[model samples]
Target: MTNTHIKTLTAAILFVPLLAFAAAPGSTDSIETRHGRVDVIADADATHLLVAGKKIATLGVGSASLFRITSAAEREYIIVQGSRPGLHCHYSYRLLALSDSGPKVSKEFGECLDLGGAGMSGAEPVVHLNSRVDPEAGVETYQWQGDDVNLVFESPTLCGATGFVAQKNAAPVRAPLASRVKGSGRLQFLSAPDAGCAMPGVFVVPGDKVTATLASAAFVYASYTNPKSGRKVQGWVPRERLSDL
Candidate 1:
């Protein structure tokens, strides 16, 4: 109940740790009930975890950590946490955004960028994003959502920077596509030929179902299908291809 949280940034494939989390059956302390998917880092990068909107823990951890994404009833919870066997750590890990340095709660990170004026993380909180950027006009800046996913926009004079999300206090008929819209990126609209892009070692666009391996950086532009969302448009495909984004 202490509400302690941490943020970190590191460079690793998105689901490598998830693979381990899914495989470890011997550790009774192993994490279960992951709603989405996650990655864990160690060492000096642990400084990113924050609690109650304040910096709390660092990467100084020996206990096992778990990354989980839990979605239920139109809600998704992407989580990264560490725990001992029934030992209370006093922190409820919540991701402000995934970054390369690690989980981040600092305002300098994209999780704290202009961030629109939407209310989030208080009630049935959800972080929605659909911001369009134009690089030719010098708009794209740095985006850090943990350590493995920090990016500076390279596409210039582009579109699809629509950052929008919807919330309802009363039961309403129209359900907002906030998750789909906020998660959608303009890049997915890019036309892909048999091959991908040639941004001079800048980005490797995936043509079909691809894998995000370690040390691999690809600015993927893809259109995907989700049972929850109709047709997700564009988003920087996670080197891990997170969902239909």
Candidate 2:
């Protein structure tokens, strides 16, 4: 082949893939899935989710910043995250499951500060949703079952604040009260009341104030707020590790 012809052919070959994969002005990169390629296209007024060129769902005026296909227990799903319409601090998410008929929205959450970390928990797909207005509400855990979405857990928010308080049972051995961490060592925070629940790596040193609620025989739900960062974390702490203050 002539030198000019060979150069032209090489350039055309390199440009083909770019044309095939390049997203339109207002769309996210395509998410390849077993069912098909998933995409979120945004226009002046709304954003649309499409699978294999078939429209699956739509959101109000917003731009999709996240789009991906994930699987759990052998089932495939599409997760989309974006800003909530007319809200600067809030975001929204849509969860869709793939089927023989195509992909369909199973759950939709709005007015969230963030939604991400799509992963697997045993046979279930898990995601975290944090509230924009309620910092004390902490992060919410959601799991997918077939085509449905379930709220499996809500992490504890800051103590002394009027927000979500996880209750393991109808009644507590001790009523909610202000308390302080005991001992010179750090007290670890657990995700649940049970010791088997994973520790969230949060700790409170001696004299750190905490609001103890939902007390069981051995454990008490404690919420601790960092004075400087204003960050909060709540979880179960052994009842013996705290002292009434």
Candidate 3:
């Protein structure tokens, strides 16, 4: 080969290896905490959870494309979601704890359902699991005490209704039936108390009487008896929408 041809061939041989390394699997990432940093690596076979360069766990991808990492308070967790063929799904979560000895895996929770969402809630940062139990979805709360995570509250998952378990309040006194203020226009009824939950629409007309069954900080649960059909309609209505009859 000529001198120029030999130089060109030599350059190609050196460049190919660098390209392969960039595309290689088993890449690693890190997230920093108050004390040190946590490490994660993804390989062809499974994703590895590491801390201080020591592998703590190997999480297979299973039916998911990747894993999701999230943090709450001072705690960190890894989440993986996957679906099966028969409308079944799984949500897996593993909590990571950092100590002086090393990084340790605290607890692993695997929930089987259609799979919805999980997050921290309430004043003490309890874990809340929101799943589609029936046609409706509600929250099941768990409190972490010491090394034990105990189920605390389970909300009813019924369409157009709300109930709670383990609530320590006296029976809710239904407010005397009240009429929609004459000039209040149309009251806005929601499927849930939160504004973005769902707006099913106002089920009652102006001046219709509605009894408040439950009251919260921002809204009231009201039930109305239709004058014509006698069917009962109940939903969340803004507390500002009704006046004493």
Candidate 4:
């Protein structure tokens, strides 16, 4: 998946075959979902999907292709996919929850070499995300439990071979909140938000106050004195992982 984001970017740059949708000339447009109305707004000349009037996600320029509404367990889901056509079509998907607050992104697959079979359902409703990389392929099935999403199942293996199923691993445990010496609780911690990015040599525990040294659209690079080892460490983590204190 190293070229995932690159492929998405390239698709955005390429000329897209326009779909059959009527446009109202304005800064924003609205579409109805099972949960609520989603408005696509223009911000700084870029297109963004707004839920509850809040910017939930940005739509790649010229990359908008299809919108699919999926129903499971009496709830609704909105799927927006961008694909680049060729011998090996490159594509990416964003899974959103249709909720009272609007739509919230649950999973983002930057760009897949080959993607298929996004539908899945059960008592709780699961969304299947699959990708194939040459001879190796994998599937990650996720379920939205309340407002949080959980990766309940995963299988990876050589193409056309039987794959072993495994439960998704839990997030790393953090130190107690009482030990926090610095940094606001709103600050997010991450494990690489994008492909090919380096993860921290060790995970940052909650109690450690880390200094953010760099910022990007998707991640922040932070440094902190490790409480366990007393050594200084730094790495890139996703901006979405941190919540308000």
Residue-by-residue lDDT tens digits, candidate 1, 139-204: 222332333233333222112111111111122223212222223332232221111211222222
lDDT (Cα atoms) of all candidates against the true structure = 0.27, 0.57, 0.45, 0.43
lDDT, residue 112, candidate 3 = 52
Cand. 4 Cα-lDDT: 0.43
Clashing pairs in 4: 188-242
Worst 10 contiguous positions by lDDT, candidate 1: 1-10
Segments in model 4 whose C-alpha atoms lie over 4 Å from true places: 1-31, 39-45, 52-55, 59-62, 72-74, 82-90, 132-135, 156-245
Candidate 1 versus the native: TM-score? 0.21
Best by lDDT: 2
Cα lDDT tens digits, model 2, 122-239, are 3445555665455555666566766678776655531111112234231354556888888879888865444434365788999899987665446677789999999998877787
Clashes of each: 45, 1, 1, 1
**lDDT tens per residue, model 4, 4-112:** 1221110001111212222222455555656666665544445566666777777653243334433444555555554444536566656566755455676555465
CA lDDT, candidate 2, residue 214 = 66
Residue-level lDDT of model 3, residues 156-219, one tens digit each, is 4311112221112112446555656344567666554544334455566577788876665456
RMSD of 1: 19.4
Model 2 segments more than 4 A misplaced: 1-25, 67-69, 85-89, 131-134, 157-245
